[model samples]
Target: MNEREKGGVPDDALIRMTLAGDDGAFGELVERYKGRAFAVAVGIVGDGDDALDVVQDSFIKAYYKLKEFRFGSNFYTWFYRLLVNQAIDRWRKSARSAEVPFDESWLAEDSSPPDGFAYPRTPENLARDRELGDALQRAVDALPEYHRAVIVLREVDGMAYDEIAKVLGCSVGTVMSRLHYARGKLRETLKSHREG
Candidate 1:
């Protein structure tokens, strides 16, 4: 068994081990984050195949740039900067209006209505969920790239504002602004969908 797989080795330790010539330590990091990375990538790029390429490229770039990673800081935050940038670049290149799949489970998050209403297990409610999901997908796809990145990083990935600022290389206020704008746009789209 690899040293990283043995127990609760911290990310910093794995990074140090990787720097000391243990490739497997880096592999452990990849295994730890790849799923979330793929999800973020897909959210940004709006295509699974493009998201995969972005994730792979981001990992390769992160591997080569490991020497630049600052100690005493979160690795995932640094890595996500690269991942988000790659996804945005891919999205810009393609400019495709592909549908990004929305996870219905997110509806259960704190973003739910203030009334604490839950959709019951009825055919009508299920149909409404599907419609909502589709509207959300379209709304997300319509956001500008940076706004989309902010929404995906903040909402979908549940990242803190400061962490998102770090990843996006912007101020916390900027992150808040972008998030507000993105959320406003999404809310407008969804509201129109429901009312119509």
Candidate 2:
């Protein structure tokens, strides 16, 4: 029985219900954020199968650890941090293994075709934007893991600076500074690609 099935209350109410042993309340949280959480894992791991595993495991971890969850902190913030950690671990394992089957085709099906979601109308603009997007991805991947995490959470995820501070267990100023530096590097990398 979902809240939607019964005309819901606030998310915090659902959390309280789940804490009080209503299994459906936890299901509501899962159903709501599963897609976004999976997408975040995929974006970091760059592998569909691994992303799925990460999402499932992260959710299980969250559920068992719910008692430790403090009120006033965003649930998604904790979830995102867990997803990022799982992706990093998978990335490290894939790096060390020689026969892990590296192919972009699977990622391609999940990622996009050339015209998937871009705003370009002209062929030339389309090509240029794609070049920038590819360059941006490469630059982002090259960043230190923590720097990359902060930039993606702040810039890409559009999480508030305070939220990111909580997620990363850092001060808001630290989050801002990391994001500033990461964006500067991305800009420099992109400029060289476009100009040359």
Candidate 3:
């Protein structure tokens, strides 16, 4: 049974239950958010295995800090900030260890078409799509950390600006500015690919 139907408990209630020593409540929360958390982490870190590690580490850190969480705050938002920070830390460490080049063949297969528009499945179109995807990934990887975070949270994770600001601990205006800059950089990068 779904956790909601199991006891009709909201996330805050679940957090309280977890804090009260109910590990099952926390497990339910983990089951609910793991995929989304992974998505956010993978978008930031660009590697599935590393992203998975980030999510696990983030959850462990969140568990330890649960007492410090303000009771009325949105649990996901608080948890998201932790997740993003942990993923960024993982990214920084990996960046120092090795600089792996972006490879389109290595990207996960679930990427959607830009703006929800579908491209034709002709062989030529498929090849072009692969090229575009590679170009996009390379461009995203080249972005600065703040800009990259804004792009991943907004475009990759479909987070609202205020929500991204909350995750990043920045003003909504900063989120907007960063997103704009990131998108502009992406367009410029892709445009070169198109011309060449």
Candidate 4:
């Protein structure tokens, strides 16, 4: 068994060991964060393939810059910032290209809708539900980068405001303001659909 598992080492300790040449420590760190990191990436970039690339690129960048990480701060927050920034950068770079639409197939396979409204199995209900989901995704995709980042981190990833502030390199107030603005925009965009 790996020393990390045997010792129940903290992230900081694992990081220190990784920097000191114990490669398995870094693997442990990756194992611990991979799911959250991938989710953060997918939230920003919107495409599974692009999100996967962002996660890989972020990890590679983190590995090289581990020594520069501040010792006292949360490692996950620091890594989250890296992952978020990489995903945003990728999104910006691909802005001109045809965006690969956000895939919602996993939502059905993995669990019920976030709203928990189980639509009847009729074809019309299923079609309308799919349409609504697509519309919501488009509304989110339309948000400006800063607002989108805050919304995804807070709502999609269930990050606390302070945690998001840390990951976004901003104050909690900024995170709140951005989230409010993003939510307002989404409301405006989806209002007509709801009324109809």
Report the C-alpha lDDT of model 3 over 149-168, residue by residue, as the tens digit: 88988887888998999999
Candidate structures ordered by lDDT, highest first: 1, 3, 4, 2
**lDDT scores for all predictions?**
0.90, 0.74, 0.84, 0.83
TM-scores, in order shown?
A: 0.88, 0.76, 0.85, 0.85
**Candidate 2 local distance difference test against the native:** 0.74
lDDT of 4 by residue, 92-164 (tens): 9885423335344644556665586765556686677677777777877788888888888988889999999
Summed backbone clashes in each candidate are: 0, 0, 0, 0
Candidate 2 lDDT over 1-196, as tens digits, reads 9556774666677678889999888898888788877766655665568878988988888888888877887788877777778777876677632122333343343556466565435657556656666677777777776677788777656789998788778899999999898899989998889788
Candidate 1 colliding pairs = none
Model 4 vs. true fold: TM: 0.85
Question: After aligning candidate 4 to the native by TM-score, how far in Å is the CA of 69 from where it should be?
Answer: 1.7
